[model samples]
Target: MTDLRELQFYATPEHPCSYLPRRQAKTLFVDPSAELDQCNYSLLSDLGFRRSGPHIYRPHCEGCSACISARIPVNLFRPNRGQRRVLRRNQDLEMRISEPHFSEELYQLYRRYITARHADGDMYPPSPEQFDSFLIRSNHHTRFYQLHHHERLVAVAVMDQLDQGLSAIYTFFEPEMAHRSLGQYAILRQIEITREHNHPFLYLGYWIRGCQKMAYKTNYRPIQLLINGQWVHCGD
Candidate 1:
């Protein structure tokens, strides 16, 4: 086990907060050179750290702590009525878990998703290089959950299988299928996958209160939030 104290971390200067407008945010990142094996990655996750590409980091903003690390205790999670509807809505789609790899098909879908849904976000002008760096660059534990309807691809959820649980790295779906609520369906399916694998939790990255984009995370009942270095159960 790598000692937490032995690992080095660096904090970035305050930048514009991605989730909140007009707010500055700082991030504490694990040393880029650190060898982040599954054991230490799990440890860092327990301490509220999240992985992005090859980097592991957690929010370190001063005076503002809106980004709360959220996870669903799989054994304790019970899908609400709305979530059940999402499951039913996406029942026609088949989910396949596969090793991470790059394909032009996937990239094209990602490009359309970003162009339609996130034109105002940093990932607006999605390119092959950006897609490769953000999602295709994979570690040993990375997996891609591909959702399809017969022959048509609809969604892809990028996940990392950790020692303790699975972390939802990123998910993008067909923007035109808004009626299907594919984003929520992806998370719902991931929770089931975690339970099937006998994992304890499914990390959902950071959930910021009052951020409409993040509010969907709280719908998963009995979520645990890392606060003050401890995990606290909410909405039991």
Candidate 2:
């Protein structure tokens, strides 16, 4: 077993905050040389660290604590009327789980999604290299949940299977099908999948209180937020 205390961590110099404007942000990263296995990765996740490609990191900004890690206690989650509508609207989509790999079909969808949805973000002007590095690169625990509608592939949710739960790494979908609410649907599916595997939680990454992009995470009621080094239930 890897001793948590033995792991080396380094903090990056403050950079502009991605979620909030004007404020700066700093990130604490686990040693890149450190070998990460499912055991250690899961342990790190419990401490609010998130994986970005091969690197594990957590927000360590000074004088700011807006980036809160959020997770859903799967068994305690109850979909509200809006979420139920999202599920019903996406009932036609079929989810296929597979190992991570590079494919043109997947790449094109990702490009289109990024182009249409996140063009102003850092991930704008997407490239195959960026796509490969971000999503294709993974450890043994990673899985891609591809959502299909008939013969058309609509969305992909990249996830990591951990000892106690599943972490949603990232998700991208057809921007034109915004009415289907694919992003919310993907998360609901992840919660179902977590339950199917008998996992206790579904890690939803960071939730910034005022960030519009992150507001949807709160919709998953009964979420637990990692606050002051403890996971506290944030009730609906």
Candidate 3:
């Protein structure tokens, strides 16, 4: 295991909170110049850190501690009725995994997802450059999984295959297919994929309490939340 304490971290200046309004947010990131790899990523993730593009970061707010790292202990996760419905709903689609690469098909789906779902957010004006930089270009460990329906791409899930588990970086799906609930379905499939690789956990990134956007993550039972620098069951 890497001794993350010995590594340098750079904290960003205060910025507007993305989840909670009327608040400021700060983040601590692993120094970009550091020798980051799968091993370091695993340790950092275990320590409540997460990756965005190529930079690993975590909430470092001065006066608040609402953003907590969350993960599913895959072995103990049992899909609730809604999740099981998602599984059955997407069962007709084919799942394909590929190394990170940019394509018009994926870009189109991403654009639709952002425009309809996050038009009010920072990534509202999504572009090819941003997509390439954020999802395509990364450490060689990144993988892109696609859900296809009759040979047409419907969703894309970006994940980082770390030493101990898979980190779900991002996921985008056809906005018109909201009835299928592809977002939650993708995570369920990811949990199965991680289990197939013998990985013990599926890092779902930060889950901020009282943030409606993060409420769905709690649907996955037996989740671990980083509290006071230690991993513990959320129910506890």
TM-scores for every candidate against the unseen true structure: 0.97, 0.98, 0.96
Instruction: Kindly list the per-residue Cα lDDT of model 1 for residues 14-53, writing each as its tens digit.
Output: 8999899999999999988877689889888899998887
Tens digits of lDDT, candidate 2, 51-158: 888789999999999999999999999999999999999999998989999899999999999999888888999999998888887764899999999989999999
How does candidate 1 score on lDDT? 0.90
Ranking by TM-score: 2, 1, 3
Candidate 3 lDDT tens digits, 108-129: 9999999999998889899999
Instruction: State the TM-score for model 3.
Output: 0.96
Clashing pairs in 2: none
Q: Candidate 3 clashing pairs?
A: none
Please give the CA lDDT of all the candidate structures: 0.90, 0.93, 0.89
- Stretches > 4 Å off in candidate 3: 1-5
Best by TM-score: 2
